[model samples]
Target: MEDENDCISSDEEDQLDFLLGEEFGEDDDAELYSPPNVDTLSSQDTCSSQSSQSISDPLERHIYWKDDNTEDNGNVDLRTTPFKPTRQPGFQTTNFTRRQLQHLKTPLHFLNLFMTVEFLTTLCIATNHQANYLINTGKYSSYTDNGVWEAVTTDELLRFFGIIIYMSVVKLSALEKYWSTNVLYDHCPVNDVMTKKRFQAILCFIQVTSPGDIDKGQDCLEFK
Candidate 1:
């Protein structure tokens, strides 16, 4: 009777395993990174939305492996390789440069960066203002008692958004490619790809314009 019961228990365990597998197939692997607050991130990182749209485009994706199409050890074939984007003649110019073409990244990259800075500054100012408002309004007022949870919610949202940005930067560094906010990023090591003099001028301009003082210039944007 014990032997028979052992067989029945084993059968039931197998059935449960099969049911779990069917329910979760690949989702178990995908859910490893449970975003603490994905909705909060969406509302906070507006700049990421523009960048994510470009990343979602199937046409823009590339295999990016050194041995993408060629067979290895006579075992694998083209079908076995990861998805590779067909290289166009123009694509080389885009990645590299020619007489007229310069850096692979478009001018829009700088604009997107500037806008992101503005967004962050705005967030900081709003948060500080909200804190002062709450503290000064009444005695011993707390966020929960005030019927508003904006401070905690917004704080967590920004923190995760920062993580997303850092992870993207790390991944792009690993890939040695950058794609964000309708802009591109690449560098051509080869000389004479574009005018050296023109490149020097751009480098000089960037160096000359960097802000040197922050605290000193706090009153520059005075609210009058």
Candidate 2:
């Protein structure tokens, strides 16, 4: 009777082990097959909340994230103020007389708009002043064959500038070549305007402002 009781106890232990193993295996299978827990909010609810948030926040509504092609359905408030022009558009010449309009037909008239007669006269006076200053200081002694330096006139200065512009367009190997009597350079009109000596004289003493006018230890343009 004792051996039969021992055998029954062993059978009960075996049945318990089998049941526990089946339960553990089922738990592992359930874990592997179960879906992930997601938020209870529906797609419509999430989209509506985002749209409302974007509408509330002005900065967020306009934020364009890189690689994000999604667009919000909320209406964007753009500045719609009508543009009232203060002045009439297009080139309409104002404050010009009929005589001035006739003068505008010449290219020199346009050039003089920037380089006015008063400005040219000032430059001519400055150039002459600088030349006389250099002569009085004995600085003009170095130039060979430079006879009594004549004062530069506004008309002569204008012609000088015209010659300079012409020279820039027609390049030459040497500066003197422009005035050369060589048949190759006979077509060049630089010498016809002014002699090379006069050009050199003007170039050497071209000054915008007198050196004496400038204060000591101050820049030329600086006000005292």
Candidate 3:
């Protein structure tokens, strides 16, 4: 009975050792089959190396089309293409002179206008003087017939000639032929000098903003 009990204990010991070895082998196999865990240090090193490889020169940013697709071998020279400036998308500068500007109107143009007004005024006054002279010298001075105009008298005839002379003088002077005797340039304000001064002042002000000399007188305006 002692020998049989000893044999039975040895078999139990052997069975227990085999079961432990199988469990340990399975644990080792599972550890080997599982995916590896990468270290943070190794990943950071690789990333730094890639960034260093990519870096070259700061001027490379301006160089576009510098690739294999371009004409040259993986590069392009800027000298070939060149750069031409384009007209921007807003108000551009013009080469117009000061005379072309609306603000800088020709002084002669204003002078002609003023001369026309003066001529009309002179004509009206001369006609009135001639008509009055004829009416006063007529037989029916009081005008027995209102519609009937009296025959032209010597005074009326003389006045007509005087008007012709006055108009001729006005035409010569107002044409800007003579600067000193210009009708528009009254020496004193009593002869509408203030109006002429204002007009000249406006011309000066316009010249200040635009780039030009204040072209005055007959030569300045260049009237035909």
Candidate 4:
């Protein structure tokens, strides 16, 4: 009787093992990483088959490996090589002269600094300086107004506008290949935008100037 009961117990155990194999598959390898976060996985039955195969398959055992389970793990760094941009012909000198083209293609972020300075100078000349009548007449001695205050204002305005035009048209893009707004932060360490802009203008004067090609007067704008 005991021998018959032992046989029954063994049969029940084998049945349980067969049932587990059907449910989970043969290999029994637990995936370390979650599946890709995509909506298509909901309908996909690929993982179910995979799990079953992993649980039941004796030939395919789970091996401990890193995130990328490559057979040759040491050479993995070669996967991410940095890509350099190819230099295009005439990309640097289409608009500006050779002197103006030195650092022209360096980077857009640097070019933006000079562009901003030019814009600000133009704004000051076109908007703020236009209202001054006195400085204008003073600049032209023959057209001097009777009011001394008006003449003084006009003279200041003219000089101011002249400087602005020089900065905007000439010095901003001519002398340097790249411009940096970072200097503004260096001069005034405040977080205020207005103060930084003021420092940028001041630094522009310090850095930008006429090129040594004095013979090309038409090509260069004079700045004092």
Candidate 5:
């Protein structure tokens, strides 16, 4: 009986140990799987804090409630106004008088507006001076048969320009072909204005500025 009682007591001791072990294992599992204690605030308090931050931050509010046609700073909103297509006025010729417009009927009149009478007279004088200088220096003798160069007038200069324009329109193999006496090329309009010899003379000594004004180091553009 004493041994049986001792055995029962031992079994009870084993069951108590097993139950204590189970209790400790359950406690360890609960500790491992449990959430951390970092989020301590209540849901209402957390939501209120976020709302206050959003209200305090202007950029956050702007991003949340932005509108397309809103004014930036104090300036007017350009997007609020509708775009209108406008046709600008065309260019009007108000610079010139009616008399001037009527006078510019002919192409010659238009040409004279740029190359005035004074400019042509200046060109004639310069050309004549160059020619006389070359003739007096005996340089003209080499180029001409009679060694004689008639002073060019403004009228002759105009005729020379007209002949040049005509020649440009009527392209030839050589410049001399314009004055060619061949039956196929006779009665050329250039011959009516000036002789070939006179034209050549004018072309050879067509000066704009006097030789005295020319300097080796001076810019040619200044003369232009």
Candidate 6:
């Protein structure tokens, strides 16, 4: 009886050990098969790496032609390809009004003549400064010398010629009327004395034409 009891106790101990072993196996399987949150971190890292790589390469941001298979590599014909500039668009073309165009033609003609004369004279004067100085001074002299002001006379002569030509060529209609008016006969605002004399004459005409006048000139003014 003592030996049989001891055998039964040993069997119970073996079954307990087998059950513990099975429980530990199940725990290890759960740990291995059930993944942790580290996979989320790895996915985020992969996306960040792709974004950084794209940022490092400028060509990745620019537009590129693709083939039917979505391949980016292609031949670029720079001559035939039109490129849009990265700038603001400007005004569209427009035509001038007829009246404005006609008025502009006269000013443009005068401006062209002025510019041509000014450009040519300036070029000649700049290139021949030394010659001009000698001719004006009547001798060889340094430009910075005491009496070198004589060289400036040559420039004055050139300016005088330009002014005379401009005045002779350019004219307005008002100048003719101004010359035709006689200050002695007409009352002039600029000629204050003549204006006063004309005013006195008008007063005399008024006095002579008064109601009680018995004069011939008074009668003539009355008729007037």
Candidate that would win on TM-score:
2
What's the TM-score of every candidate structure?
0.18, 0.55, 0.15, 0.19, 0.54, 0.18
User: Pairs clashing in candidate 6?
Assistant: none
Q: Candidate 3: where are CA atoms >4 Å away?
A: 1-115, 139-224
Candidate 6's C-alpha lDDT?
Answer: 0.38
Tell me the tens digit of each residue's lDDT in model 1 across 107-146.
Answer: 5443344446556555545544544454456522443334
Cα lDDT of model 4 by residue, 58-171, tens digit: 312321224445565444232233345576754454667677566555554354535565554454444333323323445423322352222122233333434445446544
Q: Which scores greater on TM-score, model 2 or model 3?
A: 2
Model 5, runs deviating above 4 Å: 1-94, 142-148, 222-224
**Model 6 worst lDDT run, 10 consecutive residues:** 30-39
Q: Which of 1 and 5 is the better model by lDDT?
A: 5
**Shift of residue 30 alpha carbon in model 2, Å:** 54
lDDT of 1 at 131: 45
Collision count for each candidate, in order: 0, 0, 0, 18, 0, 0
Candidate 6: list runs displaced more than 4 Å. 1-114, 121-137, 140-146, 149-162, 166-224
What digit string (tens of lDDT, one per residue) describes model 6 on residues 170-219?
Answer: 54354332223565435322233223232222222222122323355544
Best by lDDT: 2
CA lDDT of every candidate:
0.38, 0.65, 0.37, 0.38, 0.65, 0.38
**Once all C-alphas are superposed, what RMSD does model 2 give against the true structure?**
24.6
**In model 5, what are the clashing residue pairs, if there are any?**
none
Q: What tens digits encode model 5's per-residue C-alpha lDDT throughout 40-159?
A: 212224444454344334322222233557555855334433356574476345778998787877889877876788988989989988887888788766545566666789999998
What's model 1's TM-score?
A: 0.18
Which scores better on lDDT, 1 or 3? Answer: 1
